[model samples]
Target: MQIARLKTVDLHWSEDGDPDGIAVVFANSLGTDLRLWDKVIPLLPQKGLRLIRFDKRGHGLSSCPAPPYTIDALTDDTEQLLDRLRVKTCIFVGLSIGGIIAQLLASRRPELVKGLVLSNTAAKLGTADMWQERIDRIRKDGIEAMADAILERWFGEEFRRSDEAMAWRNMLTRTPVEGYIGCSEAIAANDLTASTSKLKLPVLGIGGEHDLASPPDLVRATTDLIDGSRYVEIGNAGHLPCVEQPDIYAGHLVRFFKEDLNVGAI
Candidate 1:
């Protein structure tokens, strides 16, 4: 739980595995923290992977400013973290808004990113009106007002029946209102279609078969933008596949490192 005190925000982050190992940074989605990747992290082979997971600004233990953060600002926060840690090379694994961040990061700092695993995200998330509606609800009724709907979108009925699902639900509701609201605003404004398509590095797009937020088609469409990129849709898992299907999700990432990037080749 070290803090990277950037100019805009102080990020809470954890760097695990060997320092000399290849850097693999994990970024979380909306309404969740670094802990979102907890299940999937342990499942990853630590032999030659230096895993980095962090709470984005305003999420988890990270410092919060106010409402309405831009995607550029979010990207800046990530860059600062990487620079501060002196991470020379990385394979960024990002989910949802974090996936968007990965796209932006690769475009902005190609030297830093060697490959990517983008899961459960799109070029553009929701329309401005939809984001506005969510913001209105949060401002009026608070985060609890939208917790149930978010859970439904994040996980399926079968997952909802378990204690793990309940735990995530609580995590969603506990997320700072400003954090959720700011990220939502950024999602509404962001469109990484042009930037993502230009990336030539090895990429593996992971989509959840049951995902309602970023459906399989949506994920595939984004992957298609990048020439030579590959796609896989995880079965039975909803939006947060890493939570509901940690083994499968982790397997995909390992395969990406071993096969796609040939991580040991470095």
Candidate 2:
């Protein structure tokens, strides 16, 4: 139950493997907590890496401040958390809104991030009007009402039919409405295309074949913004590829660390 108390919020964070090893920090999606990476962590190299993950403000055990959050503020929360952990450099893995945070954080504090793995995300997710409409609907009907439709966007048809999806549904419905809406607002207001285009660090972009939230084309398009970033697509998966296809997702991550970043083996 490690907590990093930032200037404005207390963020719940956890770490595994060697504390002195090179850091690999994971930022999760809008509604999920740090546990989002549970399935993928064990599959990653444990020899020379310290896996770190945190729940953003308003989610998990983290304190909720209020509504109407900005992406920059969310990035600041991440930056502060890392600084508290004394993480001078790291490989950042981000999914969905977490990916947006990665781009902004890398741009603002280039010295802190050594590389990035962007999954099911883009430089700009949706138009303001679209996000506003979604936010309004959630506010009106609550997250539970949208869980079925959201699950469709989040998982492939096969996963949704399985029993495992029930737990995910519970997680989604249990998320604090204020936190979800706040993060939604942050996504609505952010467009990191300009900043992301200027990033020069090693990057790997991943998307799922059945992902409707941020499709493969959009993910690849964001990857192309970086000068030398590589892109891969996972089959039989949707937005949360890490959840549905941990083996393939982890394989790409391991390859990126070894081949692209020249990291040592497990």
Candidate 3:
């Protein structure tokens, strides 16, 4: 992994495959590191592609600051990451909070984005007051307080019954409370209905059938707002479909990026 210092944050990233190939950057969800995409990345047909995955500021091994981070600031961090990588334009694959960042990236720096795959996310993440209260609770009592609730929302009941589910729960429990809270606030304040219409690049919106965080309806609504965007929903999965149903998720993503989006492979 290589660490680059951006203006507002330090980026931890890894690049694989042909250096000159079409670039595809994968941005992870909140509270998780780049390892969240472990199952999906290898399944991608990256014979002639450059795959980039990174840990966001305040998550994984990256920098962590105090609260009150804005979505725009997160977007700026992404822009700086791309600039440091020397990528003029690339396809962006983002999940959950990462999807919001992708939208802001396309809107703020259209020249840096060639295509987008937004999975389990929304234009405005419809976080209610209750959700805000929960975030506050995590800030005070720590992330452990929200672990059970997050696990319930992120995985199906059947998954929760399995040993694998317990491991996933452990991962969630290890998330930094400050980073999670900062991202929750960003989600609460996000409203991209107007900005999505301005995007002209190819986009694919995906959601899991059992996703409670960003359901199919929410993803459909987001796609509807964007011109020429496509939508796909995977069954038997929750918020992190790419992890739970990686083969299905990656198939749809690979097809969309390669054939539909016209992103050439090396």
Candidate 4:
């Protein structure tokens, strides 16, 4: 229940593994709060891995500012929080719109980001018309109107049929109306092709095989933009691999930080 009061917003954040361990910062997807990383955190090799996760503006207990938040503003919120905590550098992991935020943050402030793990995300998602339509729906009908449609896209048929799917659907419906709208607008405007192409930082892009939002080919194309970035896909998952298949999701992270670079380990 740790809350960091940043200048722009009051960000709700949490940590696990170790305070002095190798820092690994996590940013959740558009609809979810920091709790979205719950399953994935425990599966991580916690030897010396310090995990930092936070709820974005308007999500979870964090203060909701308003609608139409820019990606830069979201990144700035995170940067300010990290600065306040005295976390100078760390590997940045993000999902969905969280991934978009990670890319911009790394590009804008390379000194704070040592590496990147982008999961179930893309450089750009949905067309202007699609986002505008969604924006109109939220403004007119509210988030409850599109919760089912969002769930259908977020999960595969198998998970969609299970009771677990309802919980995720609830997560979406529970999201603040203004926060969801703001982040949707952020995603609509984000296209990291140019910034990502120049990133020299080590990157690993993970996609869910069944993800309709950011398919494997699209995520691979994102990896292709980087100099030596790599890509992988997890089965039995949709938009949120970290939620549906946490073990596989966490395994990739363990290998990257431990085997690949040998940074933080027990």
Number of the top TM-score candidate: 2
The C-alpha stretches of model 1 lying farther than 4 A from their native spots are none
> For model 2, how does the per-residue alpha-carbon lDDT over 168-262 read when each residue is reduced to its tens digit?
99888888999999999999998999999999999999999999999999999999999999999999999999999999999999999989999
Ordered by lDDT, highest first, the candidates read 2, 1, 4, 3
Ranking by TM-score: 2, 1, 4, 3
Which 10-residue window in model 3 sums to the lowest lDDT?
Answer: 257-266
lDDT of each: 0.91, 0.93, 0.85, 0.87
TM-score of each: 0.98, 0.98, 0.95, 0.97
Q: Write the residue-wise lDDT of candidate 3 on 1-266 in tens digits.
A: 68988887787888877788788999998878888888887887767778898988778877877777888888888888888889998899989989999999998888888899888998888655865997878878988888888877788888889888877777777777787888788888888878987788889999889998888899989987888888999999999998788999989987897688766643
Better of 2 and 3 by TM-score: 2
Measured over all alpha carbons after superposition, the RMSD of each candidate to the real structure, in angstroms, is: 1.2, 0.8, 1.4, 1.1
Clashes of 1: 0
After superposing candidate 3 on the true structure, give the runs of residues whose Cα lies further than 4 Å from its correct spot: none
Steric clash pairs (candidate 2): none
lDDT of 3 at 190: 83
Number of clashes in model 3?
Answer: 1
Candidate with the larger lDDT of 1 and 4: 1
Highest lDDT model number: 2
Candidate 1 positional error at 249, Å? 0.7
Tens digit per residue, CA lDDT, model 1, 1-266: 59988898999999877778999999999999999888898898777889999999889999988977999999999999999999999999999999999999999999999998889998887788998999999989999999889888899899998887878988888899999999999999999898888999998999998998889899989988998899999999999999999999989988889899987732
